[model samples]
Target: MQTILSVSELSKTYDSRFQALKRINLDIRRGEIFALLGPNGAGKTTLISIICGIVKASEGSVRVDGHDIVADYRAARAMIGLVPQELTTDAFESVWATVSFSRGLFGKPANPAHIEKVLRDLSLWEKKDNKIITLSGGMKRRLLIAKALSHEPEILFLDEPTAGVDVNLRRDMWQLVRSLQASGVTIILTTHYIDEAEEMADRIGVISKGELILVDDKAELMRKLGKKQMTLQLQTPLPLLPPALAAYQLELASDGNELIYTFDAQGERTGIVALLEDLNDAGIVFKDLHTTQSSLEDIFVSLMKEAK
Candidate 1:
């Protein structure tokens, strides 16, 4: 796992006396899908923009594949391709022409064979000659991806890649992302879809209020912060929790017909045995019980709230 991109003490400040990014430091591993999750204006896009040379950092340094982004701009930028959230293609230009032109923008030699392969991989080969305005929204999204791959960049940035797409198209894009990773592309994903990050990212980075709050392997992050809840369906509704079960701090739900207990999933002991024993002593009976583990969305929301 080589470090392909490194950001050290990076900061961005606008002229309006607002800080968009706050001393951010991150290292993107080679060939890994890293999902950057955050709320609107959480600096996800700002960070990506800086790394892709679209925005200048007010302080600190960034190196892409050992090339300083500022001093060696061309070399650093040449290794990266960006698929912006917006669809800003030439409406009158054919798909082939737009994609071909993108490759040339990076100062790369014309490789028609590579361009054809990218189009074919994105299922845009048949529509290569079609004008951009004539394509469907889904096709246009795929064409954006094709343009990003046109330059054969080592790193690809997908900024809200599936923003307005349908479920099926989102799934297709997920598969395409996986294929790109398989082809040895380091992908930086900025997405509002938590489930997409949970499904596609090898590692997750959560940012809030211009700060990188957490970065961890997806599974590890879940297991470390995830909580579990046990819901017990009571045989009879109670007006209130018994004094004897006060230590458990359980909540009454469904108008007292249900009891809910929340605990850390990684805790050494859940205290369920003692809880049930006390419940029986209080003449409380549950007909059924079920448990649910916290999801990434739950963790993400909790993190954001805590950051606030």
Candidate 2:
């Protein structure tokens, strides 16, 4: 894969002497969906702002498609489109006009066909003549995406794209993202929704307290850090865990109707066979059993804690 964007030793410090980012370095592969995950004030937005030329970096550099974001601002910015977290648009302008104006901002010629295609893809064609103010919150978000695509950018930045969106609409946006990736557009996603990252990102980058903490493939991250748990439904409820089961450190659940055992999913051995044999010896019978792997949210929370 080709490196479409690169950040090297990036840092940011406001006039208040507060640092918003610190020695951040990242490389985004062309045509790959990269998810940026972090808590509030973790510098996700700052990094994106610098890359998009909205904010200046105090030190270091960023190159978008081999053009330096600072020295070659116009060429670099031309290759990227940003859907900001805020809903900032011309309230009095119609949807069509707003999207058209955005394309013009990037020095793109008037291409009504392309504009119409983007609007239709975002399900906004019916609302093209409507004023921005007449649109709902969800519709406004869609308009932002339409504007971002109006310029036909090679790299798209979606910052909290589905925030406050309904379940159905969120899934619709997910489908749209997939189609965008299929069309060879590199996507950079920043979201509070860990599930969105888990579902959409090819690689996950976690930042915290102005630092780039970790970056890895989504599956590899979960497999290496995720835990798995097995729950057995006992044929007969017990008052509590027996003393003989102390070594397993199992937990009694469902008012003693179930027993839960947790272990690393990637461990060499889970000890399930030994535990089952011991259960048979102790006359503990289970009618059924099931297992579950830890979710991305669990791993994200633990990472935040460790960073703290």
Candidate 3:
């Protein structure tokens, strides 16, 4: 994939003598969905703001589609659209009027045909003439997306796009994001929902304390760090693990009714055969057993803990 955006040695310092971002370097691939995950105040929003020209970086530089963000602000910003987390649209203005005005803000000529398509694509056509105040929360969220698409930008930044949305609306937004990607838009989103990243992102980037800790292909990251567990429901309870099973490092669960063993999913040998044979030698019976694989959320939590 081609690099759509690049950040080199980026840093941000506020008036209060606080560093919001450290020498961050990142590259966003064109036409791909990249998910940025971090805790609150992790500098995700600050990075996006800098790339979109909303905030200036204290040091280093950014290039959007090969245009310097600071030197060629207009050209760089014109290729980007931002959907902020806050709902700050004019309540008195109709959806259509607001969306149209947003397009004009980008110095783009009025194009009713494009606006109509954007509204319809967002499923906001029926509410086009309705006042923003009269729209539901989900409808308003969709309207934000419509306004962002109004300028037909090649790169879209969604800052917690589904923060307070309901489950159904979240699903709808996910579909809309995929549709946008299909239309050749590079999407960069910062979200607290791990599942959103797991389901939508081709690549995942994790930031902590203003530092870009890691960035990698989502599946590769999971395979490298993810773990798997197998739980055996013993037919008979054992107060203590046998000496023969000590090498397995099993944990007693359900008050000794179950034995849990955790191991690396990518390990060459799972040792399941040895474990079972040892169990049988020790006369430990199991009525049932189940296995589970770690998810993105598990890895995220572990990363955050490690960062701390």
Candidate 4:
């Protein structure tokens, strides 16, 4: 895949000597949905701001589609569209007028056809003539997206785009993102929603304490770090785990009615057979059993723990 955006050793520091972002390097593949995951106060927003030219970096360089962000500021910025985290809009302006004005900001000639398409795609066409103040929270969110797409940017940066949105709106926005990806738009989203990243991203990056700690293909990351657990419903309750089964490190739950064992999913030997055999030797019987794999949220939590 071709690289659409590149960052090299990017860092940010405030005048008060606070370091917001450490040395970081990243490359975004063209037409891929990349999710940046982190907790609050993480460098996710700062990194996005630097790339979008909203904030200047203390060091390092960023390139948008081979154009240096600093030296080729206009061209680099023109290739990107940002749906900010805040809902800053002209209160008195009509939806249609606001969206059109955004396009004009990029020096794009008036193209009502494109504007109409963007509005329709966002489900905001019917409210195009309505004032921004009269729209609901969800409608305003959609309007922000419409404004971003008005210039027909190649890459779109969504900063918590679905925050505070209703579930239905989130689903609709997911569908719209899929359609945009299908149209060859590279997407980079900053989200605290782990499921959002799990569902939409081809790749995932984790940032913590001003550093990019990990980045990997989503499936691959889960496979490498994910855990699997098995629960056995014991027919007979045991007062304590026998010495013979002590090596399994099993947990007693449901008042000793359930035996829980966790192990690596990718391990060559999960030791399930050994555990069951040991259970039989210990005179324990199991009526039923089930297994489950760790979710992306689990991985994120574990990573955060390790980083701390």
Candidate 5:
């Protein structure tokens, strides 16, 4: 895969007292949905700001589409679009006027057709004539997206794009993100919603205390870190796990109604079949069996705990 954005040894410091970001390095793939996951003040916004030229790096360099963001500010910025977390826009301006004005700011010639397409794609066409102050929170977010796309940027940055959005609107936004990727636009988004990142991101990057901790393909990351649990509802309550089964490292529920087995999902052998056979040999019976895989939320919490 081609690299659309690269960050090398990037660091951010304020007043030379607080370090917001460490020496972080990342490569965002072209035309892919990359999700940046982090807690509040994890430097996600700072990193995005530096890449978009809003904040200056304390040290290191960033290149967007082979253009250095600092040395070639115009060209690098022209290839990128940013929808910030805040809903900052011309309060009195109509959606159409605001979007058109953003395009003009980028030195783009007036293209009504392109503007109309962006608005329609974001479901903002009907609200185009309405003032920003009159729009709903969700609509305002869409307008931000519209304004970002107005310039026809190759890379799009979505900072908490679906924050406070309803379920239906979130789904619509997810679909729209896919449509944008299909149109050859690279997307890098920071989101607090773990499920959203799990569902939409091709790759997941985790940041902790302003340091890039992990970056891996979504499926690969899950497989690497995901754990599976097997629960067996026993027909007969066992006060304790049999000594013979101790080597299996099984856990006994306090109620004695179930036996739980924890295993790595990436392991070649889950040992469930052997455990079942052992139970049969021991004259134990199970009424039912169930299994569950760890979710992205679980992984996120675990990572945060480790970082803390």
Candidate 6:
């Protein structure tokens, strides 16, 4: 894949001597949905701001489509659209007017048809004439997206796009994002919702304490970090784990009525068959058994903890 954006040795610091980001390096591929996951104050927004020319980096460089963000800011910024985390828009401005104004700001020639199409895609056409203050929280979010896309940017940045959104609205946004990707727009989103990344992103990047921790294809990330567990509900309540089963490293739970076995999901063999045979040799009988795969949230939590 082609690189759409690149950040090298990026760092940000305030006059108060507090560092917001530190030596971060990242490359975003064109036409990919790359999700950035991090906890609050983890520098997700600061990174986005630097890339979008909103905030100046204290050190290093950012290039959008090979144009330096600071030196060639106009052209670079013209190629990117940012839907900010906050919903700060002209209260009395009509949706259509505000969206049109945003396009004009980018020095794009007036194109009403394009504006209409963007609004319709965001489900904001019906509210195009409504004042920004009159729209619901969800509608306002959609409007923000419409405005960001007004200039037909090659790359789009969504900062917590689904925060505080209802289920239906969230699904609608997901579908809209897919449509944007289908239109060949590269998307980089910062999200706290693990499921959102799992469901939408092709690549996942974990950032913590201003450092980039890991970046991998979504499926590979899940497989590398994901685990599986088997729970056996035993028919007999053994006083403790059998010495013979010690090699399996299984845990005795539910007062010895259950045995828990954890294994790597990516392992060649889960060792279930051998464990079951050993259980039989020990005269351990299971009344029930079930297995479960770990979710993205579990993997993300484990990674963050390790980073800390």
Highest lDDT against the true fold, candidate: 2
Candidate 6 residues 1-308, lDDT tens each? Answer: 89999999999997888798999999999999999999999999999998988888999999998999989999999999999999878899999999999999998999999999988888889988999999999999998899899999999999999999999999999999998999999999999999999999999999999899999999998888888899999998989887899998998898988899998767888899999999999999999999999989999999988997
TM-scores of the models, in the order given: 0.94, 0.91, 0.94, 0.94, 0.97, 0.97
Error of model 2, residue 246, in angstroms: 7.2
Error of 2 at 291 (Å): 1.3
Question: What does the lDDT read for residue 201 in candidate 4?
Answer: 95
lDDT per residue (tens digit) for residues 1-308 in model 5 = 99999999999998856798999999999999999999998999999999999998999999998999999989999998999999887789999999999999888999999999999888889988998999999899999999999999999999999988999999999999999999999999999999999999999999999999999999998888888999999998999888889878988895899998988767888787888899998888999999999998899899999989
Model 4 lowest lDDT segment of ten: 237-246
What's the count of clashing pairs in each model shown?
Answer: 0, 0, 0, 0, 0, 0
Can you tell me which runs of candidate 3 are displaced by over 4 Å? none
Q: Model 6, stretches more than 4 Å misplaced? A: none
User: Per-residue alpha-carbon lDDT of model 1 for 138-238, expressed as tens digits?
Assistant: 99999999999999999999999999999999999999999999999999999999999999999999998899999999999998988899999999998
> How do the residues 1-308 of candidate 2 rate in per-residue lDDT, one tens digit apiece?
89999999999999999899999999999999999999988999999998998888999999999999989999999999999999888899999999999999999999999999999999999999999999999999999999999999999999999999999999999999999999999999999999999999999999998999999999899998888999999999989777898999999999999999998778888899999999999999999999998999999999999998
Please, what is the whole-model Cα lDDT of each candidate in the order they appear? 0.94, 0.95, 0.94, 0.94, 0.93, 0.93
Residue 56 displacement in candidate 3 (angstroms): 1.2
C-alpha RMSD between model 1 and the true structure: 1.8
Candidate 4: stretches off by over 4 Å: 243-247, 267-269
lDDT of 1 at 70: 91
Any residue pairs clashing in model 1, and if so which?
A: none
Candidate 4 clashing pairs? none
